[model samples]
Target: MDCGKRHGTKYFTVSSAENFKECMETCAAIVPCHSVDYQARTKKCYLGSHHNNPLIIASSFDSAHSVGCAGACGGGGCCKDARKDDVQEPAPLPDTSCGNAGFEFAFFPNDITYLGPNDGNFNPVVMKRTQPYYKGTTTRIGVTDAHIIYGQTPQNWEFVAVNHRGYLYAHQDGEYSFTAPIADNLSLLWLGPNAYSGYTRANANLEAAYTPVDSAPLEYKATLVKGKYYPIRFSWDNSGGAGYYELKIKAPDGTTIVDGTTTVSPYLVKFGCREAYGARQYAPWGEEN
Candidate 1:
């Protein structure tokens, strides 16, 4: 077997009929086989059946002299450059009127999970899944303002919202506000600490409504016990077809507490001592909380 294309992949140059067939089969087995170059003058095979081909004697070839001229120098035939240029670098970004820092508080596990290779510069905190508040269908993530970024429900992972200008904007709602600056795009995420305690529903005017929107028509009220151990309880004045409500809670330290769908009843309670610890663990959907 003769290897063709130095620094190039392997290719077969068949000298006989049987060898040509073998070479063709061998090349086919390879993942990416280069094209076969057959020498009509020599009647030799390369990557295919070259047997029974008419052999050309020096007398039969008009280009024989030119071919001979090249061989005379002992350099064989002309060689082509095989090296490729390096990959191009990305263009520099334009200077932004916005600074490099920003902040936002939101539900954990936002759209972009992996920070590419910029985790260090971004200082992303990991968000965990936890229990849902109700039993059958009322499941949601809650974001609370009281929890610290590094506390038990710490906001180690950060994300921010952006305005039409593509700069970061603070998530502003009545009674729910945090201080964080804007940079380029809002690539940070702020997850809710507890499903019930994190975010509160609002009226049309954005007034604080303790119950979630889904709980509205159903008349569900979720009560939270705030102290050393915070436990959120839930009950429905009117029951919807939904059998349960799902609740998820995050501690200041990024620990997650989740209650999957549970039966609507007198109360649904989750305990947390410092908003840093004692949050419920996340659970899968349809499972008992």
Candidate 2:
């Protein structure tokens, strides 16, 4: 496609939309966006201002369809979902090693009454009050962890979402499978490149709509190389009811890691720096940082 054929004012672009409909709505929100180009192969939306023109859109591809970005959400409704995505420079995820231990947790409490509606996220209205809920690392992703973060009694972790971000260290190459066996109100997870800057609720995986609770463990698997690191993130929300969540994992060799109170698997770990951990490199074990 002659991306630069039609020249005009080129504004900024973003690749956050994970679905066809989302890609459409994102462009509709921008006043100057003339059209949108979605790549099914990449599962990402590339949309920016053409000022009714174009400038070298992106990489070469087989086929493309020129269409308007008007979709279901309607511009006004999509604009209210500020918690959906934000325009900001992406922060780098630092390197990781076997020496590292535990995950870093952050809390976004969306409980302010005047904040209008509960968009299921900590929007800008309450963004200033965000805090570090937990500092230490835990061996298991047990259901009880919610209470520890909220300082509430058992079976009463409410009005908060626990976000854990770190690297999924693949010590040995194999198919890494993940599943949410059971969850109270809500649970979501993300892995690989999109888990970083382009993350949104639309891109999250492993929910319970397709499978029943504890009946069949529907697993989402990713073939990973040993010694390499993949950006990882999983969130557990319990604003509507008492909370309970268990993220079970299966290593390549079929060794399962379940996040129950009595079990502790040495899988999840945190790297010290907050730089570019998304570079896809092997672990520098026994090597200096």
Candidate 3:
């Protein structure tokens, strides 16, 4: 069979077709087929795995044309930058007096064995925390002033799982380092400018041990812009053992944003889209309705 158009990688072949539309349909049925070049003279079709490929003049067909089958596929045309539409540009950094770096913590009982990864347990707690059986928000994520009973059972069997969500405000633009209290099971993640998406969730594990320092802390590094709230989420599980945790932030200026010994309070504000009449409506920051 003649390879029409002679563009893109060809991994499959459709033997026969009555017309161009039928040939195009066959290409659509294949998962990896991104585009197709049809030869009307011989009623033959060539499937390609790529959208952008140099055109080649094939003598076997009187006329050759290509069409993109994949969604957003350029179909032998110039490929457009898809990221421009998929990701939102960073908004102007707010004033320095915008807010502080803190997170809201919701605690749940892990009575049953947690079978999956640490993050897998996070969503369930977040969605069910307000439910009747859920234990509810026990405390803030910062350093605890006193011993807090996160969760407990009558039989002395205790288990506590906490999910923390909030923004980390930067005073100035520069590289920043973060560290959290080392625990038996802890997952800490920071989503900044380079990797912040409303639909994307951060899930980085930070349970590394420090050799010299006894207070081994989970650490992460990210370059942040001043007056911006970088979304962050952290999940910790004591697994029925001693539950003690703290959050610490070190700015680019070498100043400690939140010391391990002090308590950091959440902003007590919410932002983003809200559900209204089966549609999402943009709600201004700190605007509650």
User: Taking the candidates one at a time, how many backbone clashes does each contain?
Assistant: 63, 4, 0
lDDT of 3 by residue, 104-214 (tens): 455555554444444234332332223223333322444332135333332322355555554554557898877775444443444542112232223353442211235
Model 1, runs deviating above 4 Å? 1-227, 237-240, 261-289
Model 3 global lDDT (CA atoms, 0 to 1): 0.44
The TM-score obtained by model 2 is 0.50
Candidate 1 per-residue lDDT over residues 1-289, each given as its tens digit? 1212111112344443223233334445544443333333464434422222212211211111111122332343221111122112211221122221111122232233323232222222212132222222222222232132212232222332110001111112112111111112112222233332322221111111123333322112222222212223221111111111223333233333232222221111222211222333333322222
Better of 1 and 2 by lDDT: 2
Model 2 spans with C-alpha error above 4 angstroms = 1-99, 112-129, 133-135, 144-156, 209-213, 262-264, 272-289
Q: What is the C-alpha lDDT of each candidate?
A: 0.24, 0.50, 0.44
- Cα shift from native, residue 247, model 1 (Å): 1.6
- TM values, all candidates: 0.15, 0.50, 0.44
* CA lDDT, candidate 2, residue 248: 72
lDDT score at residue 177, model 2, on the 0-100 scale = 86
Candidate 2 positional error at 131, Å: 3.2
For residues 1-289, could you state the per-residue lDDT of candidate 2 as single tens digits?
Answer: 2221222233368575555456666766777655555554566566655444333222221111233524433554332233134222221222334456555455556352222232344332232234533334555554644565523343335666666656666766778889877665556777876554455667766553222255666568889776456777666666554456666767788877535452445556565332323333222211211
Clash total of candidate 2: 4
Better of 2 and 3 by lDDT: 2
